[model samples]
Target chain A: MTRMNERLKKIIIIVVGLLMILLMAISFGGRERITAVESQLGSFIAPVQRFFSQIGNFMDEKTEPIINVLNYKSLNESLAKENEMLKAQVVSLTMAQKDFEELNDLKQSLHYVERSDQDNYISCSVIAKDIGNWFNMFTIDAGTEQGVTKNSTVINGNGLVGLVYEVGSNWSKVISIIDHKSSVGFEMLRVTDDYDGILSGTTNYELVGELYDTQANVHVNDYIVTSGLGMYPKGILIGQIYELVDDRDLFLKQIKVKPAVDFKKLNKVMVIPYDEYEEEITTYLP
Target chain B: MNKIFVFLMAIANFILMSTLFQQFRVYGVLANLCIVFSIIFAILFSEQHGYIFAIVSGLLQDTFLGKVLFVNTIIYIILIYVTVRIEKIMFKGNDLTPIFLISMATIAYHLIFFVFMFLLQSTIPIHQLLMHVIIEVILNSVIGLFIYRVVFKNVFGYKLGDYNA
Candidate 1:
C-alpha cells in the first residue's frame, strides 16, 4: 500500500509540473490582461510593499547625509560650476520664450487650431521592484482606482520611464524601458521625421536600436523621442544616441542609446492613462 | 508550529527582497533572498518541509511580480527536490555546505529561468546572460551563508557544533 502511494505521488507531481509549464506558456504568449486572482493579490500586497518601501526610504534618508558629508567638497565644486552654466542657459531660454509667445499669438490671430498634447496624468511612487534580476519591472502605489490602465505611459522628470503592463485595483506593475521585453518607436529630435527607428533594451539593461533606413542622417549625440506610435505618445524624450554601429553586411544602422531616466533611483512617476478615443493621429512632419 | 513559522518567514523574505534588499544591490545584481531561503530550508529540514516552503515562497514572489503564476513555484519545487537529494549524498554539517549548495542552486535557477524566458522569445544575449549568472552566484553565496547561520542559531536553536547529519 505504501509503495502504491509513493508511485501515485510521483505521478501527481509530474502531472502538476507539466500543467504549470503549460500555463506559463499560455500566459507568456497571450500576454493577456491581469486576471482577477492576480489583481486581488496585488491589491492585498500593495499596502504592505508601501510600508516596507517607506522604511527603506527612511534608511536611505538617514544614510545619505553621512555619505554626502564625505563627498561635500567635490559636490560643491561641481554644483557651483553647473549653476553658472545653467544661469546662462536660463537667460537665453527667457528670450526664446518671449519670441515663441509672440509667434503663438500671431498664429492664433490667423485662426490656427491650437494643438494640445497630453494633459491627464496620475502621479505614483515606486513601492517595489521585481525580485528577479532578469526583468526590469516594478510596482507602484497607483492603480486602476487612480485611472491607471494597462499600457499607460509612465514618465518621470528625467524622461520616459516605461509602460504599465498590469493593473490592479490599488496598484499597477510597470515595465521600464530598460527591460529586455521593452521596445519603443523613436525619431531623432529636430531631425527629419522620416528618420525613425525601433529602440530595444538588452539583457545588460542598456538600450540598442536599428534605424529603418541605413541612409538616414543619424549621428552620435542626437536626441531621440517617441514618434507618437504604439504605446508611447509623441515628443516624450527617450534618450540620446552615443554610439552608431556600422554594419555593411546587413545594410542596417545599429546604434546604442543612453536612456535619460536614471532607473536605479526611480522614486516617483506619472502615468498617462491609455485612451484610444483621445489619441490624436496626425502627421508630425508635412 | 515550525511549519507555520517557516511559511511566515518565506513571506517576510519575499517582501524584503522586493523592497528593502533592492537598495543593497551590488554590481547591478540583487541577491535573490527567496532562493537563498528555499535552499536553507531544504538543507536544515526534511524534504517534505522544504517542498512546502518552496511553494509558499515561490507563489508569493510570482504573485507579487504579477507574472504567470507557478513559474517560480515550479522552479523552486525542483530546486528543493534536488537539494534534498544532494544532501543525502554529501556531508551537510559543515560551515561551507550552505554556500556550496546555494551556488549550485543559483546557477540552476538561472539556467531554468533563462530557458523559459528564451522560449517566451526574450532577446537576452548569451554573453550578458553568463555575466549576470556569474555575479548572482557570487552574491547568493555570500548572502546565503549569512542567512543560513542566523536561521541555524536562532530558528533551530542549534549551537555551532550541535548539528548532526
Candidate 2:
C-alpha cells in the first residue's frame, strides 16, 4: 500500500511537470512582458551579477599584461609583421577618408538623419549574459527606472545589438539579433534603390536574410540596415551581406550576413526607449 | 541546515555561471555550473533533496533568464531523476559515477532543450546542436568532477574513493 502511494506521488509530479511544459509551449509566441515575480527575482539578482561581472573584468584587466608578457616573443613577432601591413593599409585608408568626408558633407546637406542621432539613449552596463548558447540574450543594469522599456532597441558602438524583452525596476533582459528566435526587417543600402528583406538569426550565431523581390540586385559586401518596419528603428546598421545562398524556391533571394555587433564581447549598451520615439517612428511607415 | 546552504550555493553558482563563467567559453559553449551543481548535489544528498534543489535552481535560472518559464525546471527534474536512478545501480560513492552522469546529463539537457525549442518552431541546426553537446560534455565532465569531489568531501567528511575510511 505504501509503495502504491509512492508511485501515485511520482505520477502526480510527472503530470504537473508536463502541464507546466505544455503551458510554456502554448505561450511561446507572444513574450510581451515577464511576470512580476520574475521581474522582482531578476531585480534581486542583478546586483550580485553586476558585482561578479565587475570582479571578472577587473581580473581580466590585471592578468592581460601578465599574459602578454608571457607571450612576449610571439607577440613581438606578430606585431612586427602587422606593422608592415598596417603601413600599406594606412595610405589607402587616408585616400578613402577623403571620399568619406565628401559623402558626409553631401549627406548633411540633404538633411539625412540617422536613427542613432535621436537622443533617447540610456547607457547601461551588462550584468549577466545568457548562460546557454541557444539564445543570445543578456541582462543590463538599466530598466524602467532608467527609461528602458520593453521592445527598446539596444545598440553598442558597432551597431544593432538586440531588443529589450523584459524589464524590472533596475534591470532589463535583452535578446540579441543573433538569437534564433529574433527577426529584423532590413533593407539594402544601395545608392540607386533599396530592397526590403527579412533577416533572422541562426543557431550558429549568424544572420540570414531573404529579400522580398526575387530579382533584386544583391552582391557581396552590400550594406544592410533596419527598415523601421519592426521593433527596431530606421537606418540602424544591421550588417553587410557576405554570401548568397542558392535556394530552389526562386521566389525568395536568400543570403548570409555578418552582424555588425560582436556579441561575444558585449559589455555596455545604449537603449533607445521605444515609447519615446513611438510617434516619430510611426511617421516612417506609409 | 545543509539544504539551506546548498540552496544558497545554487543561487551563487547561477550568478557566477551567467557572469564570470560566460567569459570563458570554449567553442561558443560554457560549462553550465548549475547543471553540474544540481547533479552533484543530487548524488550527495537524498533523491528527495535532489528534486528540491533541482526545482529551486531551475526556477531561479528560468526566472533570471525570463524566457519560456519552467523549461530548465523540467530539464533539471529529469536530470535529477535520471541521476538518482543511475546511482542506485552503480557504486554510490564511486568517483567515476558523477563524471559519467554529468556527461550524460549535459547531453540530455541540450537534447531536451533542443526538443523544447523545436516544438516552439525555433530553427536550430543539427550540426550546431551536436557541436554544442560535444564541447559542453567535455567541459561539464572536467568541472563536474571537481565540484563532485568538493561536495562529497565536505558533506561526508572524507574524500571520494575512500568511502570506508
Candidate 3:
C-alpha cells in the first residue's frame, strides 16, 4: 500500500509538471492573442472601469473639502496669488489682442496662413493619472458620449497634452505624447520647416522629444510646433528645445524638448472635435 | 470566525494596496501588502486554510491586475507552503523571526515576478527593477512588523502557548 501511494504521488507530480510546461508554452505562443482578448474584455467592462474611477473621484472630492478646511489659510493665499496672476494675464491679453488686430493686415502677405476658429472646442477635466512603472496614462472626464473619439487631440491652454486612445461612455484614456510609442511631425516655429521626431517619457515625469537628422537646424530654446500634418493641426505648440547635440560620430542630431503643458497641474482640457478641423484640413490636403 | 476574518483582511489588503497605497510609489515601487498579509495568514492559520487564503487572494489580484493568469496564484501557494514549513522548525512567536521571514518572502515574491516579466520580454531597466524589489521588501517588512503585533495581540488574542498545540 505504501509503494502504491508513492507511485500515485510520483504520477501526480509528473502530471502537474507537464501541465505547467504546457501552460507556459501556451502563454508564450498566445501573448498577442491574450492581450487582444484582454483589451476587448476591458472594452466590454468599460462601465465598470468608469464606475471605479467615479468612486475614486468621488472619494477624492469628498476629501477635498476636509483638506480645504484644514488648509484654509494656505488655500486663501494660493487663491490670492492666482487672482493676481489672472489680472496680469488679462491686461497682457488685452494688449496682445490689439497687436493681433494690427498684424491681421500683414498676415495677408504670408505664404501659408492658417487661422484658428475656436468654435469646435469641447472642454474636459482631468480625473486621474495612471502613473506606474508599467503604464503611463491619464484619464479625462469626457468620452465618446461627449463628442470625444479615438485619435482626438487633447490640448490645454498651453499646448498639446496627448491624443485620445480609448473612449468609453463618459471617460477616455489619453496616451500622452511623452509615452515611448508616441511620434509626431514637428518643425521649428521660426523657420516653418518640417522635421520628424518621437516623443518619449523618462523615469522622471518629463517628456523628451528626440528629433532625427543633423540638418534640422533646431537649437536650444527653439519653439517646436506640429508639422500641420493631416492629423494634428498646424501651429499648435509641442514643446521648447531643451538639449541640442552636434557630434560627428553620432548618426542623428538629437534634441530633447520639454512639453509646454504641465501634466501635474492638469485640471482642465479642450478636445478638438473631428468635424471642424477635419473639414478644413481635408480641403487643404487633397 | 477565523476564516471569515482572514478572508476579509485579504480582500481589504488587496484593495488598499492596489488602489490607496499605489499612490505612494517610492522610486517607482510600491509596497506589496498582499505579500505581508499572505505570510501572516500562513503563520497564524492551519496549512490548509493558509493555502486557501493564498489562492483566494491571488485570484482577486489576478482578476484585477494580473496579465498572466494563474502565475500569481501559483507563486502565492508556494509562498504559503514555504512559510508554513519554516514555521514548523523555528516557531517562536515573539522573536524577530516573523519579520525576517516576511521580508524574505516579499523579496522572493518580487524576484519571481521580475523573472516572469523578463521571460515575457518586458523592457524594464535593471537599476529600476532592483530598486523596485528592495524598496518593496523594506517597506513590507516595516509595515508587517507593526501589523503582526496587532493581529496576534489584539485581533486573534493569540498567546505564546497557541503554537505548541
Candidate 4:
C-alpha cells in the first residue's frame, strides 16, 4: 500500500511538472515575464557573484603556474610569439591609420571622433556572466543608480559592445551584438553611394548585414560603422566586411561582417546614459 | 535545517558558477555546480528533493539569462529524478553511483536544454555547443569525482539527509 502511494505521488509530480513545462514552452516566443522578479533577484545575487569572482580571480592568479605548466606550457609559448607579431602589426597599423585620417580629413568633412569623455559614459565592470556560452548576455555593476537604463548603448575600448537589456537598482543586463536578436544600422565608409544596410547578429557568432540592393558594389575589407541614423552613435567603427556571400540571386542580399569588438575578452564596458539622441532613435527602430 | 542548508548551498553554487567559475571555462563552458548539487541531493534525499532543487536552481539561472523561460527547469526535470531512478534500477548503492550520475546528469541536462531551446526557434550552433558540452562533461566528471570524496561523502555526507552512506 505504501509502495503504491509513493508511485502515485511520483506520477502526480511528473504530470504537474509536465503541465508547467508546457505552459512555459508555449510562452517561449514572448518577452520574458520574469523581468521584474529577475531585477529584484539580481539586486540580491550580483554582489555575491562579484565576491566569488574576486576569489576565483585570486585563485586563478596564484595557481596560474601550476595550471599553465600542466596544461598551457606550449600554448603560452605560441601565444607569446603571436603577441610579439601582433604588436609589430599594431605599430604598422597605427602609422597607416594616422595617414588614413589625414587623407580622410582632406577628402571629406566627416571627421569621426569617439565621445568617450567621463561625462558621456558611466563606466562599469562585469559582475556576472550568463549561464552558458549559448548567448553573450551578462550583468554589469552599474544600474539605475548610475543612470543606466534599458536599451542604452554599451561599448568597450575596442568598439561596439552591446546594449543594456534589463536594469535594476544596482545592476544591469547587457546583450552583446552577437546575439541573434541584436540589430544595428550600419553604413559603408568607403562605398558612400548611399549604400547602407542593417547589421544583425547570427547564431554562428557572426555579424551579417544585408544591403537594400542585390548588386551593390561592395568588397572585402570595406570599413563599416554605425549609421548616424540609428541607436548607436554615428561614426563608431562596427567592423570590416569579411565576406560577401553569393546571394545576388536572392531578394535581400547579405554580406558577412566581422565585429569590431572582441566579445570573448570583454571585461569592462561604458554605458552611454540615455539622452535625447537615443530617445529619438528608439522611436525610429522597428 | 538540512533542507535549508541544501537550499543555501544550491544558491551559493549558482552564484559562484555563473560568476567566479566563468574564468575557469574551457571551450566557453562553466562547470554547473547547481546541477551537481541537485544530483547529490536527489540521491541522498529523495527524487522529489532532487527535481525540486533542479527546478529551483533552473529558475535562479532564468533570472540571469533571457531565454526560453523555465526551459532550464523543464530540462532539469529529467535530470535529477530520472537519473536517480536509473541508478536505483541499475547500480543501487554503489559508491561510484554519484560520480557517474553527476557526469551523465550534467551532460544530458545541457544537451536536452540546447535541443529544447533550438526547437523554440533559438538558433544555436549545434556543432560548436556539442564540443563545449563534451568538454563540460569531462570537466564536470573530474569535478564530481573530486567532490564526491572530499565534499559530498564527508562534509555534507548522506547522514545529513538521514541516508546511510
Which docking class does model 3 fall in?
A: incorrect
The sequence of per-residue lDDT tens digits that candidate 1 reaches over residues A12-44 is 778989999988777762243667887787777
Which parts of model 3 have CA positions greater than 4 angstroms off?
A1-132, A138-191, A223-238, A245-249, A261-286, B1-29, B46-98, B105-121, B155-165
Query: For candidate 2, lDDT tens digit of each residue in A72-136?
Result: 98989999998998899799889989999999899999999854346757999999988876777
Name the runs in model 4 displaced over 4 angstroms: A1-37, A55-120, A202-205, A228-233, A248-254, A273-286, B92-100, B151-165
lDDT, candidate 2, equals 0.81
C-alpha lDDT score of every prediction, in listed order: 0.81, 0.81, 0.64, 0.72
How well does each candidate superpose onto the true structure, as a TM-score? 0.89, 0.84, 0.61, 0.74
Model 4 lDDT, residue A221, Cα: 80
Q: Each model's interface RMSD (Å)? A: 1.9, 1.8, 5.6, 2.8
Q: How far out, in Å, is residue B65 in model 4?
A: 2.4
Please give the range of 10 consecutive residues that has the lowest summed lDDT in model 2 chain B.
B60-69
iRMS for model 2? 1.8
lDDT of 3 by residue, A117-138 (tens): 5466779776555523343456
Local accuracy of candidate 4 as per-residue lDDT tens digits, B1-165: 266676777687778777677777775677777677677667666676676678778887765665556777767777765777686765434446766787788778777876676667676667756776777777777776666555444545553234554
Span of ten consecutive residues with least summed lDDT in model 1 chain A: A277-286
Error of 3 at B125 (Å): 1.8
